[model samples]
Target: MAKARSASQAASRSKQARKPNSLKSAKTEHARPDESEGTVPLELQQKCLTIFRDALRPSADDVAVLQEVKGHLYNRDFAAAFAKEEYLRVYASRWSPSRALGYVRVLADIQDHLLPDDELARLGQSDQESLEIVCLGGGAGAEVIALGGWWSVVTRSMPKIALQARFVDIAAWNDTVETLHKQCVTAPEISKYASAAAREANRPMLSGDAFSCHFHQQDVLDWPENVVHTVITPTTKLVTLFFTLNELYSASIPKTQHLLSQLTAALPANGFLLVVDSPGSYSTVSINGAERKYPMQWLLDHTLLSDSQQKAGIETAARWEKVVSDESRWFRLPLGLEYPIELENMRYQMHLYRRLATKGDG
Candidate 1:
């Protein structure tokens, strides 16, 4: 009899888990059937490709550097892979577009579901206010491009709210990020010999006032606790991990945990955290002196969903509510898209979580 009762309870819990959240469902119901999922617009995609091409230009040793970068990446030596400008250029040309497309699509799907109506309204009312996005390991500019593309589309129907993107990474991506930012928002620099018509046709996709970005170079784990917390400020509304979390885990699990905890503490209630990473088992750990591979998604779930011993044996309330979860999603490059280097499709896992109320809030 007891076994039967336990089984029945488990079944009930499963059913409840399968049910959709009311708020998310409401947004879905009102959305046009075609709007359920979005593709990165071809024009936006082309604009990003042009920005990358214009910024990076062409190099004679591109093929060689590409091979070297891939080798370093395969061995998990990220610092070495991104040491030189040539390597960074090779990487951006090869991978940035597809990753940007992935971010654009994912953000579009979640935009309507992100903020509570009241908070969104308050933000929209203040012209001086901007939506704050902090991107971890955003050095490559994939998240930057993605956010710019996504913001351009969203402002059409919603209020013309400004956007600020803060990129935190260990690499020396300041120069690259700045170049991309400038090219994305300002008109292209015309040649001295160019005709007036040519200059007139070289405008940027979005106006200079639409989007702003900044880059910080520091390893999150090495930073002091207070200093680490400073990266995420009171106004930070959204935080993103774009192909970044797995690398963090691979580097140092303990430090990554501390960084995550600090980030969690800093987010205001209703603030969102978005994580996207390769769906493969690239993150590894040693089990009893033998190295073993573990899926990145599993480790994240364990850290965020499971209770921690650091709570001093007290059962604390859950800190986050999962807003969107997809184990595997594909973003394919649109046909006829042209770029200097081959761009491959991306298969990523994503999770969006909203911070829950904690102690000290009235």
Candidate 2:
């Protein structure tokens, strides 16, 4: 007889089981459908289960409530230890796939604009190139896996460029990040969402694509401004922050703006910042004794973009673009598992700020 799942596991599985299956069954009409279009893939789920062994154990209602309160009000590294275990468990099984879809969508948009003609062809033809990416508050590393997997899928028919990403968060999640890296770059069987053809045509990217990640367990707010510039090269550099800026801005808008100022100042002429965050009031906290929702636009226009009058600022020549999504589908499968995250009807902002090249920029 098979062993039974604990109450928490059963509950989590039950939640994931509720995912829509109608679209997933139309495989005949879909050849290499985007992974965002349906539900999570089977191989992907099994891989997550295999890699992240930490499972969510049931806790008392009072303890759960206290922990939830603490998470909203306290520092992330100091939050409940048991909750972190549960979080990592949920992250591998749930949040990673959802966010990966979003990343792929935004990436597709960027590719369409940047490389309108033969994007995949260029991906395959380009010699090995390196990029340095810095992701803020990315301890669990869902975003890193997403970027690598998306690159693999995007260049499935071609060769992949080299990528070296640095993740900064309060927790030391390098082990989990490394495990995810292995799955994306070397072990491709588990990361199905990367290549849509993997499910339809049964071809996974080979292990030699060469994507690596580094981890830094430090407070992003306290990070030195020029650190990213110091570590990057002449390659196409990028800075990413997913679902993190809201918290920083909530704590202090000026601090968040300062961070942006430093990052944009240090960005090379071709460098850019990509920020993905939800639009809501639920994640809000008290700022100067007044409860308020996340201020998305003010930060973009004021913090990220400087006034044209300030011609001396590093970001004065930069451009900011924001996209709000109501519904857009990628590839997902009906796996009948509940992983404690709402994967549908995503409502968030995808913001990109690129530094325009200027003369005398070296």
Candidate 3:
């Protein structure tokens, strides 16, 4: 009986050893994808506080500017919304850590469906099929940093997959976004947040090589011509838009259409476009210079996507499909020092869409 039990134990060990790498990696990615890493936990939140104070080192004026912008955004002060580009940079510094968590959570939700296969993991650092991620109007490179953070937590072995991320925005945030993205990858203080989130969840953390990000400054008005050069590849796996559409839509739908059209077309079959925007109108809306109200969903559903689809000639079967729609509370301050809205009321809609994979082998 002793020998039989020992043989059984050996068999069990063999079975465990035979499990696929993807299974282990999948578990790592989901480390409380719905909790600590998803919503900024108090401990990780505290970590952000330290980084902002020591590493990021926001000045008194930066703080004051951030506060004033918040009040203006909350009060619907259009002229003051983006009065100074520096204000936009400061805005990102204040909110990106928490926003990064949010982006990771959403990405984790549909990660399985993101690609046709898990080959990216096995082919570490190979340019042959390096995964490309593009972010439109990404202020201060929040999505890129968040993705790098998520990538580290999921595959802890010095970059099991190669990633080339492109962040496109106006010139104002060019330097700021590039610098911040590099900081998140290199800075020990920023890395602590990922370690803390994993530790808090009692999950194993793997050390991985950092992903690379490139910044492109594009004029929104001229994006139709610019996108040809920026996102000119079929391998682009994902296009992320965070807290940007409302501003773009508010400014000029036709111009926004050109950018969206280019991005939607540039996607590889089976790619994804993630749009995460504040749900309600922080301000009013106007369609064709006629001032009125439009729900955030309606604006995207009827106004924006509809127009882009028609202009881009996107087919019905191959058009964008909504995959995830869920709301989570966001922090006015990632440190959790300030709750811009009550915990329950500070809601952000995380939307995911999968581009149709193929059309009759093209």
Best by TM-score: 1
Ranking by TM-score: 1, 3, 2
| RMSD after Cα superposition, model 3 | 15.4
The candidate with the higher TM-score, 1 or 3, is 1
lDDT of 1 by residue, 86-116 (tens): 7776776666655777688888788877755
Q: Which number leads on lDDT?
A: 1
lDDT of 2 by residue, 114-156 (tens): 4445644655566865556777776655566556655555444
As for lDDT, the candidate ahead, 1 or 3, is 1
Q: Rate the local accuracy (lDDT) of all candidates.
A: 0.69, 0.50, 0.53
The pairs that clash in candidate 1 are: none
CA lDDT, candidate 1, residue 72: 72
Looking at model 3, the pairs that clash are 156-206, 156-207, 158-207, 158-208, 158-209, 159-208, 159-209, 270-357
After superposing candidate 1 on the true structure, give the runs of residues whose Cα lies further than 4 Å from its correct spot.
1-37, 58-61, 115-120, 188-202, 282-294, 308-313
Model 3 over residues 11-120: C-alpha lDDT tens digits?
22123222211211232222332344444344443333333334345554566776676666565453465557666556555555445555665666666667434555
